[model samples]
Target chain A: MPLVGNLRDFALHDFLYLVDRGYKTGSLMLNRPSTDDAAHLYFDKGKLLSVVRPQRRERLGELLIRLGKVSPQQLAQALQTQQMNNARPLGQILVEHGVIGQRDLQFCIQQQIEETVYELFAWRDGEFKFQAGQKPAPDDVQSLVPLPVENLIMEGVRRVDEMSRIKERIPNNDMIVRFVDRPQEKAANINMTADEWRIFARINGRSSINEIADKIGLTPYAVSHIVFGFITAGLVEVTRPTGGQSSKAPVAAQAQRVGSTPTRRSAAEPAYVEPPKKSLVARLINRIRGL
Target chain B: MQTVKMVISGAVNAGKTEFIRSISEIEVVSTERKATDETRLLKKETTVAMDFGRITIANDLVLHLFGTPGQRRFDFMWEILSEGALGLVVVVDSTRPETFRETTRIVEFFNEMRPAPYIIAANKQDKDTAWSPDELRLALRLPEQVKVVPCIATQRDSCKNVLLELLYEIMETAKEG
Candidate 1:
């Protein structure tokens, strides 16, 4: 089944993160009911391949002509050659015809993709559906190298001023920031800007967002915004620092393990102790199945 | 009698009450009250404290189901509820994207406060707008090992399947240890 929802509930950047992490090959169809307009973005194994809007389905050859990279006659000749070949793409035909350089064509395609995605960031409310295994039209695939969505996610997040959403997770500047377990594996794909990198370096599982901001000389909002990105990327998890807790204690000490024991104990709470034995778990499984 | 507890938690109106009511042998004991906050916009009555339900495995073995309060003001109750639990089932309003962030916060809290085997129940799969389980896994930024089960909490079989999935996860952890 296609993944379907509205942009109001899951924002565009959040969807991009989903696509990137899931390594999904699909076409995301977006529609603005109020404006009666729609946009389509195609991805190949998580990298972006193209963006098309119903109101403005400008062809690559037309885009090249409009940009003065190829004259009308050059595009017409390229189109005629493409018709004869039929198997090759228009951009490839143009490059073979020496009308446009391969580098320039790729640059133009990337620029177009970025522009369309950036424009999509402004959409506040719209319905989005992602159909898996959906491919862009053969002719629509222009970029030799598919655009990785990590940078787009970062840039798109920067454009959003929804501090309210960030505040939902961060809550307060006193909240301590710490890396999630085994972050390096996931962080390999993520590319952080210098501003983000500075914040990333300061996460020691002990420093509060306030302490990190104070140490780096950046405002708390700036630090939190970048930390939000980190959180979104699954590089870290945030928690409120317990009062009177020694800073020297390892965060892992607080990182509770599931089967062996409970990490945080309180006087008011019940022991609720004992990790179930395998025999007991088997009985519970049987009982639930019988139900 | 010996008992094991499994906590069912989610944001407001994610179907916690219905989930418990569907599977519990007894009518779920709940502290539901008329909503006085923004939750009023979603549902007329909200779970303010917690919901309690039970299942009998044998005469001596019973399973306790605790549904954590959905609203943030009642967050203190979560710490109390999550203690030494066998596993956790985090229900997400699959049809409501706005609540996805809130769902993530709940997952983080439980994982931090009392790390245990947990599975996500993508509730409301009966709705056309419900995000697929695969999509919720990504949107929630859950690791690959964590299971995201498709669930319609009103259905008994679906709720039972969610419980079974959590039990299987706990079984794996127990064997590994």
Candidate 2:
């Protein structure tokens, strides 16, 4: 069954995160109501294989020609050869015929796919339906490696209007962020840029996103954007600063009184002591088992 | 009598009432009213306040179950019901991906308020459209330690299994503590 919903209800970055994490193999068909435009994203085992705009119907050979990487005559010959041997992808034929290098073809296709995704991210409303186990056309495989949605999400979130979504987690500029336990394990696949790396290094569980931005001389939006991406990737979490620490002292103090501390606590701080007695838990377990 | 509480929560129409009704030994006390908001589109009646259910552990021990209202306006009730909860069962309508975000919000609320033992009940697992527990885990960004149990809210055995999984989680926490 296909998963269908409008982007208005579920944001694009979120859906992409679902696709990436679910490792879904599907074609996400998106249609813009206002423009009546349609876009197709093909995925294989969670990675984006290709993106196609039905309106354009622009094949790899045409894209290479538009990129000034291949001549019209070269594309024509590749098309003829591709027709003769329908099994081979046009990009592969172009690479084999020396019309375009393999590396260049891959880079070109990746860029095209990235740009299409970035554009789709800008869309605030669209009908999206994901049909599982749907792959791109055999000839459209293009000899290019499938693009990881993680990297795409990192970039796409930056391009799209996603502060509202990020605010759901970060909430406010005063919210402090700390690394999740086993940070290295979670950050393994994350590809952070120079600016993102700068912001990443500033996270000490003591600095707010605003403070990080101030220290790094970047805007709060830039810092929050990166931190939001980190959060989505499960690399970090946001929390209120300790009591009497910030301008929101009263709220922070209340948080302390309520014992709503972040998961990670210092050695000196009191540990969680509210687990019900083991005897009680065991009895409940036994009772439920009998039920 | 000694009383322990476990809060059952989820988005609107995620089947919280159905879950409690299936397992609660007493007639489940639910303050359901005709839907006035957008929830009317999903179901004619919505849990306006909360649902109360119970199980007897022993002659002197009683287990109380509270189901929080599934509307944003009633979020205040969540904190009140979550107080002193032994564990939490976050029910998710596995067939609806749109509600997954709301489900995550509910989990975050409970975690922030009181980091107690909790398990996700992926309800409506019998539906062909339901997302698997593994997929729900990824979609919700739940950690590996948190359990996501398959469930059918309408089934007595299924709801009992969910409660058992939550108790086991609580037992592990109690042992660690």
Candidate 3:
């Protein structure tokens, strides 16, 4: 469908949906926000053929470590040894040394597809464009397996688009918008139910899709659908989550309070306790004490 | 004053180190040994890692020239050293036309790293029937922006011409920057 919107808005599932629906062949070009350079994803049929991005090869070792095939210490040691030998790739060396099993290494290589998706989504700037093509080489021991590139691209686009919609509803602008460029006003008179408006307000550019989902106690996919609807109506905009601006801290604090609460409280106990009225002197003392 | 770093790269035994030695004001720092196998027949020994030298063109401008090991085995290091370079001087051996593929690969690798300015010096012009600059460009399929300078690395004035072409390219890059 001529790769709509920015690739950063959609997530991995969206791409899979497209592929599953049988739209195959063509390259997907992804442009990161605030950057002119774009990454190209070549797809043959429903399968990914290759990914071309500058400086991406350097992250292979770090990606392997994150996948749990090799320990951080092992990677560090391998790098140190590589400075001396300079012949083999660090992953191959680790596999040879028995630090990680071949199967585990293979699994990590497979996981690279997802990791690539996450990395591409994490990009605050750049563009991704996808073009359709023939079916790619089948995944085998000899051939490299293609990741669900379309799914990742779709997920990123969906998230960014949703966040942009939510930011529009919250006029305060206190929250930092990460993925999308800037806050855009939603069209007035757009049809939105009261619940959708509440959901929109909570998007606030501060809460993640997960956070918004939990606050209203809805599934992430359902919340995504609502956000998508809001986006279509011009009631909100989608933005990518920025690093270190997570709303998880507040959620975690609330969780801790819930965890520490006593299970039972007497029904006879007063539900609301009113403070006694105080004189001017008492009020001053009370204010001081509160401070 | 900003210091600009440039890498001298080409195929194996393409006189990459020799070209650096000719233009550099200080003595070239290199590790050279007799060729061990078929490498001996091709040229002599090969540079292992890189060769470093400095040329102080003006009081404010100091060009740090790095000559990369020409063998394909050392291809990984190309990304490491080319990180912050201002330009590149691709030294091609006119004697061996078949090395053009490797020359193109090196140029493409540099182009991927932030659009740096580049010059291709087709060295060994003093030799018998060296290829003309047009012939070399056609064989190499270099873009027009990539200036092709013909030179015999041993000649003092010829080496200076190559350096001047690189300096002009760098100045243009600086203006654009």
* Interface RMSD, in order shown: 17.9, 17.8, 36.2
At residue B130, candidate 1 shows an lDDT of: 94
RMSD for each of the candidates: 23.1, 22.5, 29.5
Which residues of candidate 2, in runs, are more than 4 Å off?
A1-273, B35-47, B175-177
Ranking by lDDT: 1, 2, 3
Candidate 1 second chain TM = 0.91
Residue runs of model 1 more than 4 Å from their true location after superposition:
A1-274, B36-47, B175-177
Q: Give the Å error, residue B2, model 1.
A: 0.8
What TM-score does chain A of model 3 get? 0.35
Q: Which structure is stronger by lDDT: 1 or 2?
A: 1
RMSD of 2: 22.5
Write candidate 1's Cα lDDT for A4-113 as tens digits. Answer: 99999999999999999999998999999898879999998999999987666666765665445777677778889888889988898889888888899998888777
Q: Which scores better on lDDT, 2 or 3?
A: 2
Q: Please give, for residues A1-291, the per-residue lDDT of candidate 2 as tens digits.
A: 799999999988899899999999989999997978888999888889888776655566555554557776787788899899988777888889987888888887787678677768867899999999887876452327888899888888876547658768978788887755433334443434445545654565667876676555455667888889888776678988778547232111222211222222222332254878888888888888888
Clash total of candidate 2 = 0
Pairs that collide, model 2: none
Candidate 3's displacement at residue A225, Å, is: 57
